[model samples]
Target: MKILHRTEIEKILSSLDPIPKIEEGFVQYSKGLATVPPVGELLMEKGEVHIKYGCIRADEYYVVKVASGFYQNDALGLPSSNGLMLLFSQQTGQLACALLDEGFLTDIRTAIAGAIAAKHLAPANITAIGIVGTGIQARLQALYLKKVTTCRQLIVWGRSAEKTGDYQQDMQREGFEVSIADSIDELAQSANFIVTTTPSTTPLINVSQVRQGTHITAVGSDTPEKQELASDILARANLVVADSISQCQQRGEIYQALKAGSIQGEKVVELGNVIAAGQGRADEQQITIADLTGVAVQDIKIAEAVYLASEKK
Candidate 1:
């Protein structure tokens, strides 16, 4: 079996545009053309690990990914995210390649998925983008959004003032007009298109703070214990979309909202269905929220793409 390291995987990703593939993966998944089992998770005192595996029915290979986050790793000068993906031949049941991406692929697929969410769900006239969190995902979400929206103005809010300042400087260097919001309320008021990328267990954005015509993509709550948006926000949203309805029933903002008796299960729609049916926000005045818990089909598609690209080289 071939083994590709993080550097090689990064190089491969640099040459690839994964948005289309990820979009197709979601469509296939929602159509029942993919096999993705429930996520396996291990929660620790300072970190968490997730094991996701699945295969697209039409694809030649299946993928297994293990990704973890140690919240306190930064003090040791190490990236908190780390993991790898394994691709196996479906026909022979043999491992075909090992992608030692160290969670880079996971991050890329997620960011691309966020862009997909924006492409289908965001408003046409996006004045500014609001980013909640100052981590890697906050940066990637904004960068990937450029693929779907032309809006380069950003207002960011984070718990740490220093981190928000750093995020502003970093985004400004990338040609975006960045501003730091002192609170989530300020960020919500300034930008209609918001992306929340934090692992906070408590709600950050409340329904009262959200305005009409706002689209919020919550990506940090892959686990049941993590939540970033108020349950009332989902209850108040005109449209609520999930990357996977089944997955969201057990995790993410949807689960929290459902548990709180704020939103009904029938009100939730899968992201893939919305994409396939070409259905999104009915009007610019509607408020939309997409609860993204991350899906294994994403790993299957991205891993297969990287493996195929390596052969071409």
Candidate 2:
């Protein structure tokens, strides 16, 4: 079996177009062409590991991805997330390649998914993009949104002042008009499109803070205890979308909303359905919310792309 290191996988991924590939995976998933089992998780005191695996019916390879995150790793001078993907041939059930991507692949695919969510759900005209949390995802989400939207202004809110300032400076150098917001409410009120990437157990953005026609793509709450937006905010949205209805029902922002009884479980729409049908949001005045908990099909598609690209080289 071939072993591809993180650096090699990163190189292969840099040349690949992830948005189309990810969108295709979502379409396939919604069309019942992909087999995705329930996500497995192992929670720890300081970190968590997630096991996601899936296969497309017509694909030659299936993927099993192991991803982990430890917030305390920052103090130890190490990255928080690092994991690998195991590829197996569907025809022969033989091991194909082991991609030690160390979660780089996950980050890119997730950012692309965020972009896809905005493309279908966010308003056609965007004044400003609001970002919560000044981490790798915050940077990636802002950069990818530029490709799908023409918004020039970026407003960011972070728990740390220094980190938020650093994010503002870095994004400014990257040709974005970025500003650090004093609070989440300020960012919510100013920007029409907001992406929340913080791993917070408590809600940060409330219902009263949002304006009419606001669109929020929530990406941080992958676990049961992690929630970024208030339950009331979801109830107030004109439409709510989920990447995986089953996964979100068990965890993510949707789970929190459902448990609080703020929104009915049946109201949330799967994002793939919107993508496959090429339909969503009838008017610009409608408020939209996308709860993205990530999915295994995304891993299979991205891993397949990188593996094929590597083989071509």
Candidate 3:
């Protein structure tokens, strides 16, 4: 079997002749062949770790993903999560490829989702994008957004000023107009498209802080105990979508909202239904939210992308 590193995966994804529809790709995955254990957890010696795993098949190809996460404030150095992918031959059930799960596919797939959401949700006149984290997800979300929209200004925020400086330099090197914000409130007030990428236990952005018609993609919270926005935001949102409503209610940002009775059960819509039914934002002034906790089909879709890229090489 061939091994594809992070650089190779990124290169192939960037040079694609045509990109797949991320939201459609994810929705199909949700309804197709995907699996996850309802945000369950296991006890580790240091603390606790959450596991979410699954595989999906379409167009005669299949992809499998296994991801695990851990959060420890005291560690302060090691990454909180690790994942890997396995690609198999559909015709023969043979293992064809293996990926280090360096989060290359995961990051890109997520950024693709953000891009898709922006197209269907954000106002057409949105000029500034705000990112609330300086990590891998933040950078990828910013980079992918540039590909699918006209966002000219990018503002970033993080708890660490030094990390923010590093992110500023990195984005500037790519020719993106980048700035740093010390406060989440400042970033929320000015940005039309806001992406929250940090894994915070409490809500970082308040409902009043978000500008009218602003589109928010809450990306960081993939499990219980991880939250990125206040409960009230759900109350005011005109449109709220989820990668998976059942999954989101158990662990993602929407789950916290549901627990607080902020978002009613009837208000949540599936991303798949949105694409299939063309149920998008009703007006430009509508405040919309897309909560992505991820699904198994994305692994399958991205795995197909990886296999095709490998063949081309």
State TM-scores per candidate: 0.98, 0.97, 0.88
Q: Which stretches of candidate 2 lie over 4 Å from their true place?
A: none
- The alpha-carbon lDDT assigned to residue 72 of candidate 1 equals 95
Q: Mind giving the per-residue lDDT tens digits that candidate 2 earns over 1-313? A: 8889988987887787878888989888888899999988888999989999989999999899999999899999999998999999999989999999889889988998899999999988888999999999999989889789988899999988999999999999988999889988789878999999988999998899989888999999898899999999889898899999989999999999999999998899888899988887778888899999999889999888888898899
Writing each residue's lDDT as its tens digit, candidate 1 over 137-235 gives 999999999878999999999989988889999999998999988888899998999999998999998889999999999999987899999999999
* Best-matching candidate per TM-score: 1
Query: Each candidate: what lDDT?
Result: 0.94, 0.91, 0.77
lDDT, residue 1, candidate 1: 96
| Poorest 10 consecutive residues by lDDT, candidate 1 | 180-189
lDDT of 1: 0.94
Which of candidates 1 and 2 reaches a greater lDDT?
1
- For candidate 2, the TM-score is 0.97
How close to the true structure is residue 158 of candidate 2, measured as C-alpha lDDT? 95
Of the pair 1 and 3, which is ahead by lDDT? 1
